[model samples]
Target: MKIAVFTWNLQVYNHKKAVLSKHVVEHIMRALFGHAATGMPFIGTLLEIKAPRRKDTRPYSEESIEKIVKALQDEFQSHEFKIIPRIKAIDCGGLPNTREWILVIYSGFSDVSIESLGFRKKIAHLIKAENLKAILKAGQRTYRPRQTYHTHGLADIMPNKNHFEKMDTFRIDLKKDPMKTAKEASRQSKLLHQGDAFDEDGDLPLLKQFRGETTGIYTSDGSDYSLNIEAIKKRGTKIANQDENWYRDGCLIKAKAVDSKGEYRISVVSIHLPGPNHTARDGNILNTFKVVGFRSNPDILIGDLNTHTEVIRELYRDLSTELSTGTTLKFNSAIDFGKTKYDRAILRTTSIWKHHSIAITAAEEISSRPGKIQPIRYERVSDHGMLTVVLHDGGS
Candidate 1:
């Protein structure tokens, strides 16, 4: 038995503003799964799909889900598959109208069960735990006024004094000046407590806040001096927020397939990690593994990790087999930035399937010239190249 799995990141927000036409949808489906003539059973993990809604700025409605399902069904008229769509909304401050979602479509399976790990809730918990540590560290510090620089004009210069008067203007060295550092830390603690560091819902703020203060000193000879203090304040280290970045909550799907010989269980996790913050992305991936439990790793882990770094590779090296689908992202895309290999799939080494091969499909030629290839639909449909994996059961 062989099953083909496909993973793609549909750039819904940037591609057609989340409004996909039926033709475009059909084009994408055909490119990934091939025509019904092939008669291949497969599973697809689609990320960043914008659900249809009445308004552009409204959260996806139930009507939208129905419409998406209808679109899938219309495309795969001959295939019998289950469409599992999960809404991954942005709710950091308040619910925004972001309609990004993850859809897992699978067929040729006897039974399938999907589970929502509450990925966002896990992200919140991780952030809050780090914030508490930051607060504790801030509590031990004191607040000190920043250094001031004073300059006097000719009128203020005494007759006996030199024509020029200079005061120490160098920036305060927080490392050398423990007092000042402690003071700054105390101020940070206060700001964090005042809800300035975190959002209304207690989640870490996505944007940094600016704070400035000025203190004036009176000098004899009718002269005055002032110190202008400024600081870029944030409660703790910045983490990834689904609302602010091109991120959507991921889910785990499990299925049972029956063959002539017997039945086998298949587990797959579809995910899209935050791209801006590397530290946050790494932490989230590790946290996801924890949530999924290392004791029972999924058979297939597929999605856009937003990066292809050594750290990420090392994390999965021992647990799974990786497919090197070169440059799974489209060229000249906004997020491309010279970095490729964003989308990927990994199969557990202990899975029942023994062999696999990969194919890159949906290459849309932006230019009539040769070698000017882009992902099918590119900006119009998606910015990611479609990747398909065929898993073999190693039996006749």
Candidate 2:
């Protein structure tokens, strides 16, 4: 079987693209899931969701910008937009209210039931659940002109005949693995196909949400097997245990999956180790994750580890022994990583599959696409380019 391991850090586009948090999504979905003429094989995407900013600084003065940047950096925190009675544009006066700020969400998709024609859905129900009324009810009418929230009915996510609720999605959160206690996890693979019986509000809200760094695992819509984040652990104590209610990051998502071939293992980790102590913590996280994958006898390990200079060099050296160090193409970030450096991903070797024909999409290619341009933000959809690894699970 051919599978694509794709990892991208969508710095959480902060502009009109993130307004409805809709159109920007469609563009990305279309890229990987759009080709109907040719069916896409299994793909695992480690999407590091972009984050929401407290406010866009484009319209502010140099003095104010310096102060805000200093305050966030000094305190070691990223600000999220607060609930405003009426969210207004940051268009300082004569500035035509064009720019918008948004957040980076960590979400993934695979094994979608109704993705054959494409992954299109009306998401009005979703909007209400997330309580994004500020974005939907901004000013004269709706902040997002294209939002499919029917003018007459509930938001379209589960709108009518084509509703996600009816599709029987097999979702299981690793934090509460329903099958781990079983004698053998693989034996309980059938559980993934069961209907949506759990209370969405209670059981799986955090797992199945469009929030920050929430790793997702969607099994192939046609496959008989299913995958779940069977376990989760924090690598960096500080990064994982931050006090902020809105911020969530630094996690190792160890998954147990059963396919037609049988039970196997893999991992999706997002390590956000920042500040002066980043390099050491980053190493700790990577080393720990690799050891686990090896013990589990896995397929692949996909996700981000916010690595910088020394950490990047060390990661490649450490994984060289077991994992295939495929081609790594790093892209530049607007937030200067000491000038030229950018975010990158590197996949190590495992037992279940062989890596081949690996490639990274050109930054220019994705960056070139035209959209509602924001002077300082929109040019870069994501600071990091996507890394794709082709894996052959059969006779290599």
Candidate 3:
């Protein structure tokens, strides 16, 4: 089976977002998945959906989600691509937090299955009830009781909370004076934690919390099966993933499917660590995967890791295996300021059916379908082209 995991940062700003989203879906479907006529492709997102803004600045509620999704479903159902969304948690942005960036898996290829892992009890509940695993978090950060696990979401149940062990990192500015930096860092941290202000430099804790947010996993809905999910709780700074560039979550999910065919275990990890300054953190994250058993097991790592060619070369410098990063860029990252390779991937110990490195030019075409009510011309959506890694295995 040829599978393509493409990453697109559709920074859509249309008020009629549903219409634009439909276009995005079709565009991506054609761009990454072998051909539009090919079987429905499975798409996973480490992306965000900006909500329709209002003066009140309220978080996205269930009603808003229902209407928006219904529209998308009505549009997608005809194409045989069902939107199986597991809403992990509503990311209430601070001040201008105008978007909800949950991880979502859009699969319509076949009888695909969905599962929720991590400390996302509310997300799990919704998954069970709606039969959709959400792109959500294990727990929400709160200051009321200052506890790890707490009640969140509209649901009554309290979500489970898991913490990342503080890791060792060489990226911290050892060049700076420690006494002065600590005093500054400590004061900034205290202010940010207290909500006294929203200075950018004082956001380390928030960044850490965001990077370690809860994420989910899924499989094709084939045959009756039972599932078991494991989360690698212990992490280190040296072999961990983080970035100061943007605020988002890191995902590492392990899933097993057992049915008549056989039993198969596959781990999927999505990363958003930026670089070249964060090289130590990025390397540590990869090494952490090795330490946590992802090295030996069949696994697929994807998302916007913000790596350049030299960095990629460095990452694979001493590798003893032929396992390759799935997508090769058609453009140079140095000139494009690394965005050319913003969304790169690495796959090892896994079976890949195909790999398509696609960079759609400034190409435009009119959609023939009346579904595109407007005389809509398709366009390249994001600045960074999609690097799709189609990786899977023959069942055990």
Candidate 4:
């Protein structure tokens, strides 16, 4: 069995404490518990940590980074975990954010290397997630100009009837970027479909219905709805958790992975909203939480929420009680307060999953363990520190 865990602190800052956090390090170990339950052979695993770009004296002393990594190696003491440290790498883009911070915690299975088996594919997807900043930036350029929101009366429900009839066949040009196509659609003033759901707020926000069609990028008027369906479609489809209070026009997404043998597994969308302070009036942060609450099915949600980890705990508790699925994402927040490195994920199955204690480890501490540590450092990773967790289950 194999699993990869990661966390990033986008804007938050501190020196030694930032490099590693007890909250995050332990989380990675617990998250892996699930894989271990599968009884798979133990292979060497890589613990990759990256710090965000900062100018002043480095956020953390190299010694601090090294100490944390060493502590982890000593703590596990088991051959099962091959604790690595200080894995640094170059970045094509400068840094993550202006605040200058972000960290990565990647723990691979003990037996597999990047070159062997299906590890490459898994690592590739993770790398893509790591590079979401680029993807979002690209989306902004392609979607902003053409974006619009509309509401429709019952009569307008059939606006696209004429267009649909004229075209009996639907063809999506893979070569042409779909985002570009959606942008063009956004720019059109002419009504393509009647009862435009996006223009204004209705009983059901338009973005919610169209979430599956798009991926999860959106830009809408604060009151009504706005979602980037094109991006959602390409990345994965997700729906929001079904909480009545947050039953607005939003969505949650799930990821589907297919193996070479034609086998597949599904995962829920993991998301983190910017600080509520940054976008409070629109209630974007609260809306995001409510959406997660309302979404149904199996999922794992994670991100730098800009809210306290305690809030995440409360939401999970409410969701568990309301949905009757005793499940939650646990975090350890001892070092820093306020926003935590919100790294989390979910499995969409209907069964309750098991968990273990969680921790947060430093990047440099990992480096001191020379033979096993290989920290991949990058600049401007993000503001919030990286977050990760390990899970344990017998595999249902």
Please list the Cα RMSD from the true structure of every candidate, rounded to 1 decimal place. Answer: 12.9, 21.0, 15.9, 17.2
Regarding lDDT, does 1 or 4 come out ahead?
A: 1
- Model 1, stretches more than 4 Å misplaced? 13-36, 51-60, 78-99, 132-229, 233-248, 276-295, 310-325, 333-339, 363-380
Off by over 4 Å in 4: 1-5, 10-266, 292-296, 309-352, 365-383, 394-396
Model 3's alpha-carbon lDDT is: 0.36
lDDT of each model, Cα atoms only?
0.47, 0.31, 0.36, 0.31
User: What TM-score would candidate 4 get against the native?
Assistant: 0.31
By summed lDDT, which 10 consecutive residues of candidate 2 come out lowest? Answer: 114-123
- Greater TM-score among 3 and 4 belongs to 3
Q: lDDT winner among the candidates?
A: 1
> CA lDDT of 263 in candidate 4?
27
By the TM-score metric, which is better: model 2 or model 4? 2
TM-score of each: 0.59, 0.36, 0.47, 0.31
